[model samples]
Target chain A: MIGGKGISIWFFIGSLLLLYGIIITIANVVEMVSPSVDKQPVLHELNFGVWWGILLLIIGSVYFFSFRPWKKK
Target chain B: MLGNLKPLLTPLMASSSSLLSLGWVDSLIIIIYFAFVLGIGYYLLRFTKTGEDFFMAGRDMTMWIAGLSFVAANLGSLELMGWAASAYQYGILATHWYWIGAIPAMLFLGIIMMPFYYISKTHSVPGYLKLRFGEGASMLSATSFGFMTVFMSGINMYSMAIVMKVVLGWDIHFSIWVSSITVLVYVVLGGLLSAIFNEVLQFMLIWLGALMIPIIGLIETGGWSGMVARIQQNFPGGDYTHLWRTMGSFQDNPMGIHWTGIVFGLGAIISFAYWTTDFLVVQRVLTAKDLRSAKMAPIIGAGFKMMVPFIVILPGLLGLAVVMPKLVPENMVSAANPHSYNEVLPLMLARYAGPGLLGLGVTALIAGFMSGMAGNVSAFATVWTYDIYRPIHVKLTKKEESDSYYVKIGRWCTVLGVLVSIGTAYMVQQFASIMDYVQALFSFFLAPLFGTVILGMLWKRATKAGGFWGLFAGMFSSVGMWAWVKLDPSALKIIALSEYAKDMAENMYRGLWCFLIVVIVTVVVSLFTEPKPEKELVGLVRGCTELPSEGHLPIWRRPIFWASIVLTVFIVLNILFW
Candidate 1:
């Protein structure tokens, strides 16, 4: 049991954010991988999708890993 | 008008669109969703053995569950559908409700107010007022809150029905009754616990259900910049993309609300009152097992809340840029009906999502209404039982009843609450601008309630007489102002700079004046009226109470730290959109 009040929840939320970022970044990569999508006029603007993902990832990772799940306080 | 995305409309933009086009798969998805909601309620019934279990979820809710439910209860048909419509009509400016209007105040509540609330062990917001200002204030807040909750529930019901009627061509009465009865069952059976649980579930579904619009719309438009370029090309000088630019002057903005009204009237007073004091959301936090969880709930909720505009508000902007222009002619005239934009959310759902996804999308809409209605009904029941009914019962009978007796009454109140909400939903059909009226209710109920509670909590000298009279004065002033504006447009013109300052029609300015009346009256009356003894006020008053130390937690995990991050994001978003 994580003893801290908000520790575990932060980890969970952070991980979710990181996961969201990874997924979107991965999707963009996949679309970019496709020659057809790349050739299309769309700039594949990852503006909000990528940036928000990165922000969430940072916030989520910092919290998620703040306390080692395996360590005892 | 969604220029580049026009091709994405394809089959969806076909002349005929209805629920039948959603197919059997969609219907099954919706059916399974409802069954799951009701099934959980019935399943949770045995756990609800006591009034505590029913009303406060036995006060054992964790930070995540409580936090998610806190945000979820705030979202509903109104947030999803109404704001989507507002986004359609008002543009990116509508995002104010999600960002500036919400984030700062929610952080304030989490950092400042939650300690007092959690420590008090109060069953409801009115119960808190009762401790500080005495029972008269309690009863007034309770009765007004009780009415507000039911009416709010009805508005949710009405909103969903209208969306369905416009989109799927369903019978409004059928939709309203269906949602009302479902909410009545789940809430009555499992009470607050069920409501909270469903709220969390509804929260996830809403995201899964609605995220497609911005996703598909963004992709089709080649991304945010592309969409912006298209919108600029299509609606040049329309004030659609810029957030603060239009707020320079009332006439500059499409919505016509100036920066002062948005900031002071809405961002401070209205937002703080709703996020901090409204029991419907506050009750969720109070149910947390401990103070830490309670404080964490709203902060976590603020995180989620900051993201909501991307889902709800963008659809509205997309509607204006894409769907509305496609659905109507370029020369189409504006009407008073917000539902015209309200349909934008549903259109986005229909346009992008299909088959199983469509079912999920539609279910998301239903979930929003049911979750919203259940939230209101459950809140009404708690306030009615603890604040209104129980006190009256004890006074009349000169006795305290069994926990079971009160529980029974709560259950009965739940039923009555649902019925009243359903009735209110029927009444809502008469109004053209439903969301405006719903927002107006805050001026009438919350402005005064907030006045009393904020004064009572912060200032120990706020006497019972002051609290009661302040509440009365605040509500009276608000209603009188509303009436004055309605009966005599000249009065509104006199108050505002221009006939078209757009401030006159806004509930924000009205709430501001009402809030000012509440504050002035509350302070004046508090000065004159005799205050209660200091001994009587302990934990209820700030500085008199000992707040728990959270120093052990690191800065990253601290509420203030997260609050700063959220505030930073808020500033960045405003600047980016400006």
Candidate 2:
């Protein structure tokens, strides 16, 4: 009953992805913040790390929020 | 912010990794990824108590997990590297495999084939064949599929090792064992659910790692049009940039696959055989909680499948446009060259992905390889335990076995299957490019298997004998075709109308012929043989069963509706990229 028997697999998947994305976005933001004047990291432009994080967060949010834990009916 | 960032080009370029290097940050990222994947398997193992839980995730998967896992299983390292390599060598013509070759069949599976498969409640594809065609066909399909799965796993293993060795200078044995051992530990401990869960994670990583290359490359080249201009400038008279223009004739294109062959051979036969019947992918969908989710799985996969070419194929085109100039002199000679085409994705990774990002990209490659290995191993285990072992055990013992006993057998099968795959991996270490060998095997096994399955599901009169013999004849024909080319040099040329017919071994054409022969043989044999009784055929054949209605979801939410949208995208891509 760690995540509980009733929790959908998507909830776990979404939670993991959401957490991973947050970590990546935070790391990138920190990295981007320290860029030298007139010189920027390529990571800022492509933002795949952040974008993937965002996409995973959205997907995870959908799965997590959709779960009706108390709606036995 | 990325616009002003000039891609730091590595001055040295070779297929060998001795010239390239990795730093501490990259290593740390890799270690963390490994720990996380292993942790997932260890945690999931606690929940996987029975055969169903292990193999089918206790039938609790939602549409998204099932769909993502289904597509992820197909997005193996071989697929990532091989298709990218194909694009490097064959140019845009390789897009056919992703578009027409994949979409129509995926949609067909979602809309048409899903009902029969899901309703039957079969654990594996071979189990489906057992119900439809009886023991002879099931064993044949199972044995062949079991063998093919391992061999294909080996091909993935070999390609992964080759890519790493060529690009990073990793020891071949180290690369092989690193992937195989990692996959084996998790798969054996946690079974199919572990594999599926990891597959979804790997899918995310694959997209994240591969997306940067195309985006950065397109930016540098001034978008698709700019990339097209660069390709033309790099190699003129090469219709490498045009998708359909070079497809008019075999001689007109770089791939030498004529429009006719591209459509009939690859689009219809090879694609259908793969997307429709390959248990490596279909088993993922089969793990869904219900028939509705099962049907929805491939529709969602198709939508994602359409976008995959952008991730895999664009890197190859970019390799040609940019990386080729940096490598040797002025030329596009990769296909037959020693491990040249296989270097495309890695080369792009070197250029665009630096430092911490490089670790993620490399790990993505590793993830792809392990997921593919795990998929094959899991599928092989299911077939061996359910289709091959159980019947023999029952016949010998004259008693029914416990569910837990069978689950134990499945775990052992995973171990045995992985061991055999390791052997095959080392067996074909000599072959540089595995794309052809793998395709030929698919034609031999899947074309005939697909022929039997299609007929059994669609035509009620398809007898068990017809199913078995037709599958055998079709397989026999493909092997015969392979041997014919080995003996007679002009055999493929005689069958092919286009002048530039010798580019590939033409696995596509072989698959087409195998499909036709199976259909004819099955039909002819079914007519002479006795058909199954109408009562027994319920839910197994098309007309025999009433189709289920989709729940009252909105228009956009329906699987069929989404399938149509994916198809529309497919058509639009063909027109735009043509």
Candidate 3:
């Protein structure tokens, strides 16, 4: 009973969610694998900064583009 | 006798200057904000002419207002205060709530679930269930949802009141009265329109306040790197190094991410159920002009959800590093108690943020609290008027009289809902973790409803008997799990229990076991029961399609579906290992 347009939209959204989930999951894996010293991990901020920037970019683009509501008419 | 007397005398002995001398600036800001909210509510009263107008804003809400209110309602003062408190106490694992749970659930709810819901053309989530499943399922869902709405609203009020009391050293009753009166007046006067307009203003303030802290804090700390270094210097460990690392045992390490099972398993399930099935959120989407706008609401909200860790969680982590070190050991003891997590952000704002920014921060907290209250009040009014009252008052069938009566009743319901929530807030001091308490309370109702709605939509075999039984099973199992956890602490050890699991069990209500048990029982029981009439299933599915000729999945979207599956698998593996 799902429509072609509805399916297409769901597919696009599902992909984006999955991609974002993977990126976050990978970031967690890198955090787990990275070596730790007695008290601190070297280059923690630099590492976090890189991933944080990437996430912000992706999320920001999505926010800007979402304003165009897809009308059924 | 002396030990007992100290508890009674503590309030009288405490300094009153901090409460009374909240300077002209803070007093002025609060007064202006209060007046503006009341003014808007009174102005919007003109629009509440009919039931639709009062309950759903005449179903003419645009994407921007609906989207903004949806996010604002979900991000209450408790969220910011709770996040800061958790980050202050537990390491960064709290951020997973945003990254792993809320974002995905929001998107799925918007894109997948909302279209189906909008097509159903029902006013509330439970109303949709009544159409899809049967009356019994709808009533059960409504009762459960009602309990959750009132209890969580109470928690939200309590958290906001406590934050204000902590910041200004005001009396707890004073904080409660101010929040309750302001929220009750607007919701009573304007219904949903007033709620929405005020929510728009509240949303802006919350964003302004939440963002202001990190900006001002970063400047004071010399920038992001300096702030990072400051935190590192204070709370030394690998736990603080990355956002993903756990803090070992939960008991010894108060900040440890011990509820991984709950987070990934039950947390994911119930969050999806909530965003997809709960009426407070679904009501906003249902009010959308079209299916596309309805879908856009949550997707837009998800984008904002991604920013929460930065605005709410990170600042809290930084606040603890910056402010807690300066406090006396006795003050630290009172601040770090598990029950007092809601006080962390407000304490940080009062201690560190400069004067001009402090007004804005406090305004944001109030706005967040009010928006959540407004959403619940509006939704409660809608359900009571449309589902409960109108059905019972069948003698008045004339269109004009019916519409007039419904609107009047909706307003009354709004007032009653607000009053009850305020009363409920008085009891919030009893709960340990506000977040877990709200979530567990919600799961009791949400899981069963989710089972019924999803099955009713996808499977024609789901009958009223099965739907009702599944609902009972789901609610019972979930509540049983929570009650068992409360009564028998040792029982949790059977589930490959981590040491942190034991700690979280003592403090927080675990609902994952209940959610899974409900879903399973709902499905299994539905299979054994008779199929619903084909006409019922067909009618529910009709709204989900575009046109008679166009198919469900166009050929063009096939590759995207495959790619998504691969990506989901990849994420699953990463989370499992990481």
Candidate 4:
């Protein structure tokens, strides 16, 4: 809704990021429990996916809620 | 000490082919990205009813949207991967392109040059030339700009396809066709608006996708100081860590460049010309909602532009510190040496990213490549329709055509441009690296165009004949110098002014020489030719134009205020890194 109305670009960005975050976070959680055979990087023990996913979810949620097209109306 | 740690780092490089495969989660992320972009275009289709809407995004983009898209359009994955590769090959010297090579010119465009472009109501850069310099200059620039832009789109397209092939083991032909068609569908549907929206999204994806490398990389290396220490121990006697200390002599640094070339050729001429004159980026700012937004767009872009090196350059530096069996140049790449310099970004992503993150990284790159191609094709469509086709049509018909007719032509031209780009993508496969190829193309067209443009906008004496001939002479001389070096490799010493100057230095010096040629020729020709009436030159030239003031806005609201802040930070970063 940046230029007078329609679905805001931020909403699109947030929705996609939120969706990807949920998927990534859940997948990483399951992987942490099962410890799959897939080769991991040097700091894989740090579980970067879970934290990075959480970060995306937080940022995306802020954007999505703040600029939600319905809210603008 | 660093040499002793090589064995431990080898396992972390993720050199095995099996590790590159994307799981279902990764595939889902990429699919989602594609769906959203296409949906954006479809949603915007109704808003794009007129020619102005198609070519200019209805001239309603906010500074935030326009500014982000401005930088994002130029931040194609080709450049991301290429510059990261450059950082590895040339060390911190590659950061110059992001900093001095871009920031100063962007600020100049925002604070000084943006007024003329905004106030004149021109549709494209070539449209501005047409207003000031008449048809000869406009046609020449429009043709060349259209040509190079399409070729660039093809290069971007091919580069992405090749990266997909190399990194994910995806089929190159399938990658090229799929990506090109997706871009085509969207651009044809919603035009520049679609491209700008996608570019904004791509900018975010690029950050989210690539930011992990620098973050996790610093963690592994302990920190910036630790990474610097490791690099020093690994490449002892190599001037890789210091930004300016090794810039004194051509032989002192890995890039084999002198400070004069970096300052005069790169920072002064090439960077200024590209940022100020290149329509692909300028068109973004041109879509700003108002005069203030137009002026503010590039300045905002410059701020974000400063941080780009983190994602592009740091990965290359990280690769150097940890990657085993040193990456070789393209010519040296084979079964025995599978890693080339250009593969640095993808290699680093594979090394650090697991299943879900891997998809995001790949999606980011795909977004970069598609947005780049879309930007070029969209720009090409506008220039081709407005500058080239419309002029010819009016000449034949002795009247203007309908807006819908022109819009129809723009859509068709987009399709044709994409087709031509696909052909050019195949042509690019024969080249070793397209970075130098693209740089050479920029020098030929943009460097000279900047000369004609800056003079036209500044000096009232610059006549139509002067602008046309100046542009002709500059382009001819650039191509002539390129041929001179090609026919006799020793001529590089004369052209670049040093035997130690490499391909990168050669590009900068060439841009500098061409710019000088255009200025000298324009000045000489204008002095002999009759000048245009000052009244007629209003809005097109500086002195004759009555520029609109920003009014009594607060100091924080002024463009100059932000520009100064950006400039101060720029100076500080150069000093800190130096």
TM-score of 4: 0.95
Candidate achieving higher TM-score, 3 or 4 = 4
Q: Give the TM-score of candidate 2.
A: 0.88
TM-score of each: 0.84, 0.88, 0.76, 0.95
Q: Candidate 1: where are CA atoms >4 Å away? A: A1-73, B1-20, B327-339, B429-439, B503-505
Q: Measured by TM-score, how close is model 1 to the native structure?
A: 0.84
Angstrom error at residue B366, model 3? 1.1
* Tens-digit lDDT track of model 3 for B1-578: 43564544343231453422233333434555677788767766766677666777666666656677677777788777777777766656676666556666777776667766777778888788788766677777776676668667877777676666655665677677777788888888878767776776776667655675565567667786787688788766534434444433454444533555545553466567777787887787676676656766776666666677778877766675576433222244444442244556665565443322445567677778888888887888887776665654654653434678777777788777877777777656754466566756675677567667777666666677777887788778766666675687666664325434644442233445555565677677777777666655654643334522224657443323433443364356336424
Predicted candidate 4 versus true structure: per-residue lDDT over B1-578, tens digit per residue: 43564553332222236326776677777878888899988888988989989999999999999999999999988889999999999898899999999999999999888999988999999999999999999999999999889987887788787777777777778788888999999999999999998999899999999999999999999999989988888788776666788989898888888999999999999998999999999999999999899999999999999999999999999988987778899899887768889888888988888768988998888988988899999999999999999999999999998999999999999999999999988988876476466647666888999999999999999999999999999999999999899899999999999878898899889999999999999999999999889988998899998877767889899999999999999999999989
Q: Which rank order by TM-score, best down to worst?
A: 4, 2, 1, 3
Taken over the whole model, the C-alpha lDDT of each candidate is 0.75, 0.78, 0.62, 0.89
Give the CAPRI rating of model 2: incorrect
Fnat by candidate, in order = 0.00, 0.00, 0.00, 0.62
Q: What DockQ does candidate 4 score?
A: 0.69
The parts of candidate 4 lying over 4 Å away from their true place are B1-19, B333-338, B430-439
- By DockQ, the best candidate is 4
Cα-based lDDT at residue B484, candidate 4: 95
Tell me how each candidate scores on DockQ against the true complex. Answer: 0.07, 0.17, 0.02, 0.69
The alpha-carbon deviation from the true structure for residue B55 of candidate 3, after best TM-score superposition, in angstroms, is: 1.2
lDDT value for model 3: 0.62
